[model samples]
Target: MGDPGGTDYAVSAEFYDLLQAEPDRRRAERWFAGAAGRARHGIVDFGAGTGIVTRVLLESSGVPVHAVEPAPAMRTVLMSRAAAFGADRRARLTVHPGRAEDAGLEAVADLAVAANVVGCVEPAARRALWRAAARALVPGGVLLFDPPPVGLPDGIEALEGLGPVRMGADSYLADVTRVPDRGVLRMVFDYRVERAGLAVRGAREEFPVWPAEPAVLVAEAAQAGLELVAAPHPDLLAARRPHG
Candidate 1:
């Protein structure tokens, strides 16, 4: 979103859904379901990577969904999926090929979701995200997203065995690790696909993420007329745009 182009997810986009575990989707869906229940107007989805959450929002929520995605590769799949949905549902999903921070929406949605996306940029870009969300949301509109880690940890995360998934005699696997570099954390995603137990394709994608804590987000959002709200879970954070 704030990173401008989703270049970071370029190569990994192909294996994204294949690598994502069902539990991960369930966790986000719980939040989505709650938002769907609360959102009376519509939902503005930022960083709609490959329509992972977009489909869920459409299926669970009848509200109109405005999805903003910048990466061509990722948007291709996102729109492709939206195309397959029934005409009624398809009509409700609008895909914007640009940065969420530049979506130019003004108080049109009741809920905004930027799931698993903020960690892709530094604090300045993240600030743009907060400001954009604040502008796009109606008063009391809630923005749901994952909070960035305060600092880098000392291990690798395979995203809960996010791979080794078999596909037509091929297997794909991935792991995520953080590295501190130049005062920012580098989120590294390593992926590999194997056929006949031999490596067929592999890629390593790196993104510079802010190491700022949750307080930074609260403070940053506040500067944009948003206040932190008690989220249903600690892993996620909710910030509401204030009226006037």
Candidate 2:
């Protein structure tokens, strides 16, 4: 989770949900809910990110949920959402402040997830997460994650139009450019907001991500003592720890 705005998700935190509403659900959210519905024990959501998936997990799964998020801005939003939940759901949720690798969960979860978060850090950090999840999971538990759908292009590629999401008179727009630099993928998010045809605010948010291709991802998981399970989608991954 490399920082650009003095914090990991400082700039994008406000507009994240609005801009990512549909695409985020389409990516893996539906499946995430289904998995939670089928879960028996507990769940660990690494990089819980504004409690989007955390909300789903809390609703579908009767088990306790540990939501881990590192960014203060993102966590603030996450806490807001979790606090608004009814007593039952709120009681089952515990929000933690840390990265996935630093979450000292010891064999307490039936499932562990790193939703759309694996590429946020470098290879070593990703491996640390895998190992941490392996340690936190029950012997037969599974670890799941959504990897980046697209990587940085050979040099630089830009997409000028993403959306102009309208929430009343305010219009939010997002554009992105991908740059391959120094063995990492840098995604620059250009965000703008308009109030009744007047530009109000804008931000250029940069995120450095690891381009973990499928083969390399699998290898890394195996090295952390987890074996690849049948993935729900070709773009997603699930790895299971050995039954001891």
Candidate 3:
């Protein structure tokens, strides 16, 4: 959601889901299932883009969920999805119109999850984002997320690739380029959408991501009162607030 001077989600939002592979959804579902077991009251989906993870948490846990998203276009889609839910699910869902770094949320949730979002946060704002998550949780509450891989793949110089995907009548092509340097990956996502054999939409979103070492994140989180905990999944990192 936090575009940060990059192309907005006006066009990209339409093809966002297409970018998510089955494995990505399954990973999120598994993480949510584990976190939901420990949650007592509510949960927060920090960057609830299009409510993908938010919907999973709502249906899986049937608990109150705060979906914090920033981009207007993406939020529009999320709100629409939330509106279509049954009364029971709707009653348990809240969509916040802000980024994770400063969502101004008041509810102290039992669990907080940020999926594929930490890497997109600006370096200077990462601490604030983590601290905000720490402050939003009740004592002993957990935060689960998967940051980008710590380093570039072996022998991969400035990763770049393009792929084509289709959703119903729309066809889309996504071009991804990443240049890793100084612990940061400067990534760009360029998309082109076509309908009826004609290119109709396009978007280019660019941002810098800091892939902090696991140990570094643990230390930083400790400063914010969150103790790093061993995660069940190898790709995920979990932290917990100290119990009173």
Candidate 4:
């Protein structure tokens, strides 16, 4: 499950505010607060787009924050937002220009988080990213993140079926529906579209979208030498690098 539909931060960065406003922000904050508590030092928001969660951790939780954003445009927005939150002060913040896998954090951070950014890569790449984050942490440091879901909107499949849409291809239409369970919400992605080359050509397929399922993701982390400490919700899970 590489970044299907091409998850471009430069493009998505513009609509990031809308994306965060959904239940996503609330979900992330809960896990981050818990994960940071395990850290003796401070926390780093890996792939911290626009610094939304970063600001929340700084303003609400009063945690020292460091943000990593690879997209230049997103980093720009994040820095501006951090400054507004008064996160530039030593007591509150630091902003870095990097990605989850390549951030040159000076020391092993207390926590590293990647909220809603794991879906940007294919599964193999995502595994590599997890390993990278694990390498940046201290023995007891934590890593938290959420992958999209196996169930996306049906419309998205319809749209993707139109053809394997190129990275910079024109945006297509998609509608998402929520299937509620006792605890978590499963999103069924529905897409509608016609083929690109042959205007008359069209089709649809349902991809079992398991964005970032806790079982699979946690297992991957464990394989990378992380220990699953807590997973408050399926959509939100936390693992800590094992201590000696």
Highest-scoring model, lDDT: 2
Better of 1 and 3 by lDDT: 1
> If the candidates were sorted by their lDDT against the true structure, best first, what order would they fall in?
2, 1, 3, 4
Q: lDDT tens digits, residues 9-60, model 4?
A: 4444444454344344576566666555555677777767677777656644
A best-first ranking of the candidates according to their TM-score comes to 1, 2, 3, 4
Q: What clash pairs does model 1 have?
A: none
lDDT, residue 168, model 2: 88
lDDT of 1 by residue, 1-244 (tens): 3234355467777877777736546866887777766678889888887787887788778889988888887788777778888899988888888787777888889899887778776567788888989988999899988877778656544344456799898999977776777667776778998999999988887777777777788889999889999876667889998776
Q: Give stretches of model 4 more than 4 Å off.
A: 1-7, 18-25, 60-63, 87-91, 151-216
**Candidate 3 clashing pairs, residues 3+ apart or interchain:** none
lDDT of 4 at 81: 64
Clashes of each: 0, 0, 0, 22
State the lDDT of candidate 3 residue by residue for 47-145, as single tens digits.
Answer: 787777777788778678888887888888788878888899999888877666566765469798888777777655666667878888888788888
Give the per-residue lDDT digits (tens) of candidate 2, residues 106-154.
Answer: 8888888777678777777778888888888899898888775445577
Model 1 C-alpha lDDT versus the unseen true structure = 0.79
TM-score of candidate 2 against the unseen true structure: 0.90
lDDT agreement with native, every candidate? 0.79, 0.79, 0.74, 0.58
After superposition, which runs of candidate 3 have C-alpha atoms over 4 Å from their true positions?
1-7, 21-23, 152-163, 167-170, 181-183, 194-202
Question: What's model 4's lDDT at 162?
Answer: 19
Question: Global lDDT for candidate 4?
Answer: 0.58
